[model samples]
Target: MTDFLNILLRFFHFSSLLLLTGCLTYLMLLTPAGYRNRLEIRLSPALRSSAGVALFSAIALFALQTVMMSGEITALSQPDIWSAVAGTRFGHAWLPEMLLAAVSFMLLRAGGEAARYLLLVTLILQLILTAMTGHAAMHDGWRGVAGEVSQSLHVLAAAFWCGGLYPLLLLMQQGQRDPQDNTAVLTMMKFSRYGHWAVALVILSGVSNTLLISGIPRHFSFWLTGVLVKSVLVAGMVMLALLNRYWLVPRFRQSPAESRRRFIRLTQAEMGLALGAIAVVSLFATLSPG
Candidate 1:
């Protein structure tokens, strides 16, 4: 069914988006934080490979979605479809994503303090741009630009909060890969502080976004259900973030063993929830702006 397939695409899109967001956080935030902790990160060969692969995967998926959505409207198909991509609104929207992804790849491959700093800045920018492409910023002219700014802040913050999940999960799975190794613990502390800052920004941006999108005049009934779903999911994400900061980080810093296991379990769940939220976001983006 076209409907089912559309939903499925959205599901995959969201999953991919969440993973991409997390990757951004990992590459930008978690990795650097590890260095700051004075723990020599094993930037193992596999880790470097993943950096390239992840960048390519995110770019490919986003491009695919743009082309597919544009294909139905235009007559472009197959090899010619790329031109359709270059000429469409979706294509225009995709330009920044492609550019950022390119930068991400280049920086990731370079691998140094300078490259890491650039990567973090780029990740923060991409998250903001991604949010701007959504319905919330589709209106409001000058105000809309401000909306994008707030939105960028919101997305960057959320990505940092949620994206840290994978890196933390990996650390947990290895379970005291080095108990005395203060690197993981130090990294965790940095992220804990960063996560709190992100939460505050998320709350502020959320209020701004809600006010902009929903008002007395525009009764956006179509989006009501999806918005509610997003709200609940965001609440859950905040809870997980809190747990990571208040409960897990301190425990892990101390009980290294139990902390590792609990962190892994929670992160796995967090990943699923993030994916589900992405699905909702993709669907919401597709709907007509009411």
Candidate 2:
């Protein structure tokens, strides 16, 4: 059962991550644009529905993971008074997930950007605080707070760019259904700009995280490996983003149909990288790297 539980946690963690990508992408980028009549015409309702389900599954799976990770797997079988989703470490984490979950439901039902923005804020808060409860922050002094913030930013930024790739790729695959949709390129630029911001913070925060850990020269092997892995992922994402913005995106803008297709492929690839990074993150979260 312990093995099964581990498997369950891993599966749910990855699934929630995929959903989280959509949730963050939709709320931060797509939601507002969608409200302003900016979405492509061929983005079929089916695609939107799948995104919603993905987001919903992410929250539910996360809640379950929280239950298990919080060391409450056995408690889950206890009476609702103690074992409930609202009464454990899972509950603390669930607060934001639950709120964001509601936001996704509303977005689907009401169909607007306001819901998206609200959801984005909630997701950010949840993610930010989520890292704080971990050993990285709670175990250290004042400096740890900054480390925590960076780690959270790192994750959030990764989700924004990485998760956004799915929908972006999907949009691209739609084949420039709207020849005049400049928003596609605009969104690409937006992600590039955001990627720059994520990178800056990632570097600064990474330094702080290094300080908390045994330094590069000291633990050059395993300790540095953790940070190095994340750095490589961030670097790759940044390069892809740069190419998308300056190179492919410009060429794409000149040709609507082709640009959409390119964006879709890029988004798919971005998501794959983001998932790989997160898988590494999950292991790091479970271990004491130093």
Candidate 3:
């Protein structure tokens, strides 16, 4: 039951973080100024929702982690639970993330450029804090610091790749409504360029994290299996992205409608793979990194 609760909380925490990071990344970097107003209207509700979820998930993770450490569900009522939470590594790392999540929730409703940027900064900090308590931080000294940095970069890059998908799909929907407008294609081209960099970073940081956390092992384990699954899913996402960037996106000029259709379909597939990867990550969090 504890394991179940842990996995559930991790899923929510991971999903919420990804949503917060991806949405903000898309709005700030990929969104075209001309389409910003319309996309903002569509994205605001999602941003607000994700922020709320992030806050709730952070609180729940804190409570559950406290309970896990105490090894008693009734620890919810113990003073030592609070004390442990206040003093432990995980608890110390989580407090600021909870505060940031609350601030981000409120800021998402502000609906201004500055507010959005601030929200992004808050989310970035929350992601970094998350890295500080995970398997990356289990190491000691400079190696631990390097692990944390690599893990943080991996999270951010994953958010850019996975979280940006929904917004991109929305933009494609807009393109469908007005097939004449090339803004969607242009924005996608820009996003694709950024995505290449993000994917590269994800790979580099992921490799670093894998080596740091588990190293080159002679035997298979559940955590290693999760990592392999995540890698395969990510590879699939990258392949689909390449197909869109090299083949389908170019067809937008000659076959706008068909290309848009194909792009949306491929994007949906990519999102599926991303969600699968996130599930693997959540499971990995629960498993011993042997």
Maximum-TM-score candidate:
3
- TM-score: the better of candidates 1 and 2: 1
lDDT of 1 by residue, 1-290 (tens): 43444555545533433444555555555655545323224333433454455456456655555445555634334546666565755556566766876786677667567766776666555565566567667766776787777777776666666666666665555446666656555566667777778778977887787667664435656676786788788788777767766787777647768877777677677777776776776677677646
Per-model TM-score, in order, reads 0.74, 0.70, 0.96
- 1-290, model 3: which lDDT tens digit per residue? 87887777778788878977987788787777677888888987887777888899898888888788888879888988878887888878998988998898888878678888898999989989989888988999988999999999999888888898888898898898898777777777778888899999999999999899878877899888888899999999999999988999778879888988999999999999988888888889878887
> How much lDDT does candidate 3 score?
0.86
Candidate 3, number of clashes: 0
How far is each candidate from the true structure, as Cα RMSD in Å?
Answer: 4.4, 4.7, 1.2
- Point out where model 3 deviates above 4 Å: none
TM-score of 1: 0.74
| lDDT (Cα, 0-100) at 169 in candidate 3 | 90
lDDT of 2 by residue, 184-290 (tens): 55555665666667667766766766666544456465545766796788677767666667777667647756655665666666666666676665555555555
Top lDDT hit: 3
- lDDT scores of the candidates, listed in order: 0.62, 0.57, 0.86
lDDT score, candidate 2: 0.57
Model 1 alpha-carbon drift over 4 Å, by segment:
1-74, 77-90, 216-220, 248-256
